[model samples]
Target: MSVTKDVAALAQPVIEGLNMDLIDTEYIKEGSKWVLRLYIDKDGGVGLDDCQLVSEALNDLLDGADIIKTPYTFEVSSPGLDRPLKTDKDFQRYKGDMVEVHLYAPINGSKLYTGTLHDRKDGMITIVCEEKEITFAEKDIAKINRAIIWN
Candidate 1:
């Protein structure tokens, strides 16, 4: 298994027990250092206290678990406003919210779309844009991120 998956697997229970969702885990080499970055979230969003709590808890577990033999910097943070909608739970939670969809190939001469997320069912995703509902197979989507609107 990949190191990111390993880290996620090891950290999942601890994160859930703390009442937070583990959004993602990324293990990457940044210059001369290895960084283990974890994205976490909760219903009303995560604050510094939440991040600190998880970080403190995971520090002991990770140190004891020795999941990484080499040295690495650990970080815990929120997924942010533009986080991608990856799972059924995410899609359901963001239903009726604006999202930006990027497709692998153009549909109607366009590869990008911004719309209200309508539904996701049976490997298909539906969105409402311009008074019309557009549905695409999940495979066609490269990503679906929550749309960050600026005033």
Candidate 2:
């Protein structure tokens, strides 16, 4: 297994046992700190205690494991209200909902698209913005999240 995969594999069991799903994981460096951001979730929602429990358990495991050699900060938290959608399945689940998408490349002279998520099937998303139907490649989305519109 790849080193990153190996680390994630070792960490998955512990996360699952705590009744949390790993929404996302990032092993990155921020200036002097290597931050391990573990975005976790549950069925209804995630709370403070959920994050605390996972943080404590993961810390204990990390302390015992020799997987990471650099000084890093471990952050365990909910994906939040505006959770970033990273997969076609994510778009599928939130289909019929509104969303904001940022693309790696401009589509029809626009890199940002915001509209009602009208479609999510066969690995593509159709967002209706201002009576115009804009299609985006599932892979080209750099960042996508459920849009919070208070209306």
Candidate 3:
């Protein structure tokens, strides 16, 4: 099995046991070191205690299984506030909120757009900036970060 799959199989139980969702996992070889990154989340948010719980459990599992077969670093973290806006559900939830997006292909004259997400329907995103509404195709979006609004 692939390292990612193997890690998921082992990590899922640890996450589920704590009543958390395993958002994502990545096993990467950077230079001579292998890095295992685990992204976890819960209903409202994630805290240090949650991370520690998962980390401790995952460490025990890794040590016991010896599956990695090499020295590596394990990192468990939350996706954070400015998490990537990937899915349609993400866009829908944050509609009317301000966001910053980077697109692979330049739209009009720029690749980065920061404005209010006027609406999102189907696979189209309409952003209202200044006085104009700019439309974007979902596939063209490279990365999107939610903009924090403070009253």
Per-residue accuracy of model 3 over 1-151 as CA lDDT, tens digit each? 9888888888898798898878788889899988999988776679989999899888988888877888899999998788876656566667777898789988788999989888877777788888789888878988877877679
Q: Lowest-lDDT window of 10 residues in candidate 2?
A: 1-10
Instruction: List lDDT for all candidates, in order.
Output: 0.93, 0.80, 0.83
**TM-score, per-candidate, Cα-based:** 0.96, 0.75, 0.71
Candidate 3 local lDDT, residue 25: 84
Among the numbered candidates, top TM-score falls to: 1
Judge candidate 3 against the unseen true structure and give its global Cα lDDT, from 0 to 1: 0.83
Winner of 1 and 3 under lDDT:
1
Best by lDDT: 1
How far residue 97's Cα lies from its native spot in candidate 3, in Å, is: 4.0
- lDDT of candidate 2 at residue 12, scale 0 to 100: 78
Q: Rank the candidates by TM-score, best first.
A: 1, 2, 3
Ranking by lDDT: 1, 3, 2
Model 3, runs deviating above 4 Å: 29-32, 87-96, 117-121, 126-128, 131-133, 148-151
Q: Give the alpha carbon lDDT tens digit for every residue of 19-77 in model 1.
A: 88899999999999999999998887899999999999999888898889999999999
Model 1 CA lDDT for position 3: 87
The superposed Cα distance between candidate 1 and the true structure at residue 87, in angstroms, equals: 1.2
